[model samples]
Target: MRVTGLASGIDIDEQVKKMMAAKRVPMDKMSQNKQLLEWRRESYRELNSAIADFRYNKLDKFRLANATNVFSSTVTGNKTAVTAEATLTANQVDMKVRVEKLATQTTATSPALADSTTSKTKLSELGAVGNADGKVILEVSRGTGTPIKLEFSKDDTIQSVLSKINANTDAKLNASFDEASKKLIIKSKDYGADPFTLNGEFDTGIMKTKTPEGNLQIGEPAKVFINGKEHNPAQNEMTINGVKLAFLEESGNEESVITTRPDGNNLIGTIKNFVASYNNLINTLNSKVGEQKYKDFPPLTSEQREKMNEDDIKKWEAKAKSGTLKNDGIINGALLQMRSLLWDTSTKVGNKNLDLSSIGITTGEYTEKGKLYIDEEKLQQAINNNPDEIAAMFGGTKEKDGLFQRMYDRLLTPLTSISNKAGTSRYSADPTLSFNEQSIMGKELTDLNSRMAAFSKKLKTTEDSFYRQFNAMERAINKFNMQSASLANFAGQ
Candidate 1:
C-alpha cells in the first residue's frame, strides 16, 4: 500500500482510472461483439423454430389431405344396422347388407358333486372313482394355438382341481363350480368363428357316474352376406369397399342400405385453416426481412451500461437488438425462396390445373408480401366437384412435391445454412457450441473473449506497475525537496 501523494499532491488513483479507461476501449468492443453474436444466434433459432412449426405442425398434416377430418360421409339408409367411417382413401359406396347369423362361443357344464366341507371329499368321493391308470387330462385350445392341459387324479379334491384350472388358463377361459349348485361350469373366452374347444380324456368311472356328460361344446363362425355375396368373417367385423361392417345380431331378411358420399363443408374448413396458418407465418417472415436496422444504436459497453439504471440499460438493449436478422442473406434468401415456391406449380400430385389457383387459392396484392388468400366459394366448389384434385394439390409426389411439400423443402436449405452459422438449441448440448468453440460466430466470439481476458490481465499488471513507479517518483521528489530545504536553511544561518 502506497500513499497517493506526499509532495506531488496529486490523486494517482484517479489518474490511473483515466488511463485504464483509455485502455479498456478495445476490451469493451470485444464484449459488444460477443453480445451482437448472441443476438444474431437467437434470431436464427427463432426463425428456425417458426419454420419447424410450419413444416411439422402444418405441412406434415397434408399426408391425409382433410379426407378423414374433412369431407366426411354420413349413411342415412342403414343408420342402426350398418355404420361406416370415412378414410383418406374412402370412395363413395352404396350397398345392401344382410346378416344371416351372428357368431357364438361354446360352453360346457360338469356333473354335480354332493359333498361335505372336507378336503377328503375328492374326485373319487364325487362319484368319479378312478382306477390305477385313470387320470383325467383336460386340454382347452382356441384357433391354431397349442392346447393348455390341466391334469387331475382321482385323489384330487374338486375345489383344488378347479383352482388349478382357473389359475393356468390366463384370460382365455373361465372355470367355476357353484357352491350351492355343486355343478362345474366351463365357458369360452371369445365369440365368433374361433373354435373354443375342450378336448381331453376322463376315466371310465367319472364318465359313467356323471349325469349330463363333460363333453366339449363346438364354436361357430359368423354368417354374413353383403349384396348377395357370402362373407364368412372369422370375426363378426368385415371391411369391404371402404366400409366396415359389424354384426350386432341376426338381421334375417331385413336389408340394410348404406350410402357413402363426400361432404364439402369439412373440407372447406381445413383449407381455410391452412390458408390462415400460411398467411400468419409468411407475414411474420416478411416483416422480419424488411425490418429496418438502427445502425446508430451500437451495443452498450459494460462501463457505459454501469453508468445507467437497469431500465435505461434495458431500453438501450432493445434498440440495439432491433434488426439482428434484417437483410441477413440466409434468412432473407429463405423468405424469397419460400414466397417463390408458394407461386410455383407441381405436376406430380395434381397434374395440370392442380395449382393453388385451381382450388380458389391465390396470393395477396403486391403490398401484402405474398400472403395467401382463399376464395371460399370457389374453394367449396372445387371440394364439391372434385376433392381428389384438391387433395393431390396438397399431397404431391416426392419428385414433384405438392404445395406444402415444396414450401417445406424451400426452407430446409436456408435453415441448415443459418444453423451452421449460428447453431441451434439442439447444439446447446455440444461442448463446441455451448463453449463457443466451433460454429462460425461462436469461434469468433471465443477468440475475442480469450484476447479480452489476456488484455485485462495485462492492464492489471500495467496499472500496478504504474502505481509503483509513481510512488517511487514521489519518494525521490520528496527526498530532493528535503535536501534543497536543508541547504537553504544552512545558507540563511
Candidate 2:
C-alpha cells in the first residue's frame, strides 16, 4: 500500500517486492509441504478403499459359502407344470410331489343394475332404484375366524361409494362395477375358508345381484401331496426344511419329481471369483508398496512452476506423487500377513485335500508377489469327482474350521487394521483437514497445518512492518529533497 520513490527517483515498489519475496520463502515451503501431505493422504485413502472392497465384496461371499456349504436345486418331472427350489439344507434331497389343488380367491357378482346405477350414478339413487334401505352391507371373514360386517352409504355417486367401501372396508374385499358384465363384482382379497360371505338387501328386485354358478369362488387353500402325504395350506407357497415348494397348478395325473443336486459349476464360479479378486488386490498392494520414490522430485512451488510449461509441471508431479505409500510398514506388513495365509494348511476335515493347491488354486511366480492363479479344468475335475471332499474343505469338520473361513479371518485382520489407520469417510477419526480428522496421517496433517498457519500469520506481520519502514524512509527522503531544492533556489537568487 506504500507508493515508493516519487521524489527520491528510486523504484521502491520493485525493491519492496524483492524483499517480500525472500520473506515468502518459508510460507511457500510450508505450502509445498501441505501439497505433499495431500498426496500422501490420497494414497492412503485409495489403499483403504481397495482393501475394503477386497474384504467385504470378495472375501465375505466366500466366507458365507464356506460356513453354509453350497448347493442348488432343480426339478426334473413336469418342470413346466411345477418348478421347485432348494436351499443348503436340502442338498441331495429328491422328492416326488403332486399338486392336488391351487389356492383360489372367492368372487361374487350382483345382477344387472339399471342404466343409472353406474359408478357415476348417485348413491342416494340406491334407495329409489334398489331397496329403500339405501344401505350396502358386506360381511367378510378369513379362515374359520369370526365374520366382519361393514355398511356403506353416502350422498355421493355409486363409484364414489364403492371407492369408499374398497378403501375403508376391513374385509379386504375389492368392489367394482363392470360395465361389460352389467354386474357389481366383489372379490375376496386372498384364498381361505370363510373368506367372504356377502348377504345384503339391496333392491334385489331392481338390481338382481347373485353369484353365477361357477363365479361364486369360495376361498380355498393350496393342497399338495409330498412323498404321498397330503398337505393342505392356506397359501400356495411354503418352505420345508430348506426345500421350497410352490404349487403352480393342480396335477391330477402323474406326480412331478423334484431333485436337488449339488451345483458344482456355480461353486466353481464362486471359487474362481474369489481367486481373481485375491489376485487383483494383492497385485495392487504389492505394486504400491514397492513403488519407486523419486526424492529429487519435490513438490513444485508456484514460482518454480511459473518457469515451466504445464506439461513439464505435470511430469514433475507424477514423480512427486509416486512412493506416497512406498515401503510403508503398515501396508507392507499387512501384505506379508495376507501372503502367508495363502501357503498355510487349510482345515483337515474329513480326510479331504485340505490345501488350496489341492483344489487348483496356486500362487504365481515369486516375482508376481502373492497373486493366485486358478486352473479351471483341475478345479472342475475335483469338484465333480470329489464333491464331498470339496464340501468338506469349505464346510468344516465337527472340530476344526475350513480353508475359506481361515482366509476370511486372515483378510479381516489387515482390513480392520488399515481401517483403523486410514478409515473410511464415515469412520475416519482423524482427517487431514483440521476441519476433518482421521486416525494416523490425519493428525500429522492437522499439526502441520497448524504450524503453517502460525508461520503465515507471522510472515504477514513482518511484511507489514517492512512496508511501514519503507514508507517512513520514503517520507524522509522526500522532505530532504524539498529542503535541498529550496536552499539551491535561495543561493542562485
The best candidate in terms of lDDT: 2
Residue 460, model 2: Cα distance from true site in angstroms = 2.0
* TM-scores of the candidates in the order shown: 0.73, 0.75
How many clashes in each candidate? 0, 9
Error of 2 at 119 (Å): 8.0
* lDDT of model 2, residue 421: 57
Candidate 1 lDDT, tens digit per residue, 1-493? 6568778988888888898888888878878888888887777777766776776677667445442233354555445655666554666666678778777666666555554534345776766643356876666666687777767887787668767776774536666666776666666666654555555553233322223455446557788777788887766777777666676767655777766666666666666766787788777777777777888888998778779999998888888998888877887787778767766753334344556776778887899978778888887776677665565566653344566666766667876676668665332222233422477877777788888889889989989988988888898999999999999999999
TM-score, prediction 2:
0.75
Evaluate model 1: give its TM-score: 0.73
Name the candidate that leads on TM-score. Answer: 2
Instruction: For each candidate in turn, give its C-alpha RMSD to the true structure in angstroms.
Output: 7.6, 5.6
